[model samples]
Target: MSRVTILVYKGFQVLDATGPAAAFEIAGHFGAPYSIRLASLEGGRVASSSGIAVETVPLAEALQCELLLIPGADNPLRAARQKELLTAIADAARSGRRVASVCSGAFILAAAGLLEGRRAATHWAAVEALKRLHPRTVVDAESIFVEDRGVWTSAGVVAGIDLALALIGRDHGDELARKVAQKMVVYHRRPGTQPQHSALLDMVTPDNRFAPLLAWARARLSEPLSVERLAKEAALSVRQFTRAFTQATGVAPAKAIERLRVEAARAAIEAGADSLEEVARRTGFGNGDRMRRAFVRITGQPPLVARTGARREPGMRG
Candidate 1:
């Protein structure tokens, strides 16, 4: 069996640790070889940011695991200052064990010197802060998760589960990973290259009036979402629909459609879709040039750049 250790510290995000642990544990139930344990710098009950306490063994006893996962805390920079913790993490990586982090937990790895000159992913909101703090580390704001050499990093919250699924797929097989996802009722393992944010979610507030209309548009991206059609779908005059959508989403109707289209196109590109022209045609962009322009305008990068970055191999060093 492969031992998996999750290291936690005070004020850590609870789900960042538990979500991946549950995925591994579920995979184990289906005949996958995984043994999980929670650990901390010292043995005892450690309280998470949410005030839920988890029992943990001392880090020393958990250091020999095949995979070591560090969970993000509400104030990760505070945890990053723990000298003994940093030393232990550095020593573990030097010993050839695979190490991974969830969300701001990447701050801990970077502090331990494991992420220098490596591509890493963290919560989109923290991307600028991570870049400023660790100039040597390549911070990928778009990807849901990233694996550089033997070290992995994932975006905020539920993304830890995605990272764990990827690891399970790598260790066992895609079929086992799919089974695990089915048992958990999540989409069958979103690729590591998948974008962390969704345009639909970003644009719609919980109580937005146009939420249903936006959802309808998202489900039919290939269909022309002209203002007239959306107005008719929402059962409002074209002028009223345009005004209301702009008020609810803070973007004009046309801009919202473009954002949604670009998001879909980017997802397809990163997921290894066959051709940009096909992706554009499928996502309502009509052609590759139009899609490329929209991509650059909204994402500050062309679709080709996204495809290339998604396919880039990890460096030799961990």
Candidate 2:
């Protein structure tokens, strides 16, 4: 059995550690042969950022760690400054053990100098800080995870499961990974190459003053969504709505409409839409070619590829 060690520290995100651990544990039930450990610097009960406590073994006695997984914590910038933690991480990587990080755990990897001059990923909220702090490291803000030179980094909390699933695939095979994902009730495991969920979802201002108009537009995606229509919905003139909506949402009215349409189209496709035409028409793309172009621009894949999650057929284009 491969020894898997999850490094935990004070303020660690509960899901960041447990998510990957559960993935491995479930895979083990299918004969994948993984032995898991949760280890902390002090090696006792560690309190998570969420105020839950979990026990850990001492790092020194963890033994022949084949895979080291680090999870992000609240105030991870502060956690990354621990000299002993950085030393242990550097030592493990130096010994050729596989190293990986989940979410802001990339901060620890960066701090340990494992990610220098390599492409890395972190939670979207922490991307700017990671880039600013580790200028030599290339940060892929749009990816769910990244693997470069055997060091893996995943974006955000849930992406940890994807990283772990990918690792399972690497160690065993795609079949085992898919089975493990299904056991975990994750039906579709997104590849690291796929983009993270839309930035449009996060572009809204904190107060969400434009949410009413956005919700209305989402519900009426099949209707023509001109700026004039959106302005009327918001009870403002076109110019006023344009300026205010941009300020409130950081996206133009028309662009936001297309994004909503794309989101609806993607949902329909993934939910087993029978044809591209129906998806396009329902999502307001009006034609498959137009929807295909929008999907390409938004998700780096055509609608058919996104729907089937594979290569496009020769005659699939409409």
Per-model TM against the reference: 0.81, 0.79
Q: Write the per-residue lDDT of candidate 2 for residues 1-318, one digit (tens) a residue.
A: 989999899999999999999999998899988899999887999999989999999987774789999999868877688898899998998999999999999999999999999999999889999999999999998888888888999999999998998888788877788789888988444657456765446667446888767877888888788899889988999999999988888778887888888877876775446889988998899999999999888778787766664212111221
Error of 2 at 63 (Å): 4.4
Candidate 2 off by > 4 Å: 194-199, 216-252, 263-282, 296-318
Taking the tens digit of each residue's C-alpha lDDT, what string does model 1 give over 32-143? 9699999999989999999999999999999989999999987899989999999999998999999999999999999999999999999999999999999999999988
> Model 2, 191: alpha-carbon shift in Å?
2.9
Using TM-score as the measure, which candidate wins? 1
Task: Identify the leading candidate in terms of lDDT.
Answer: 1
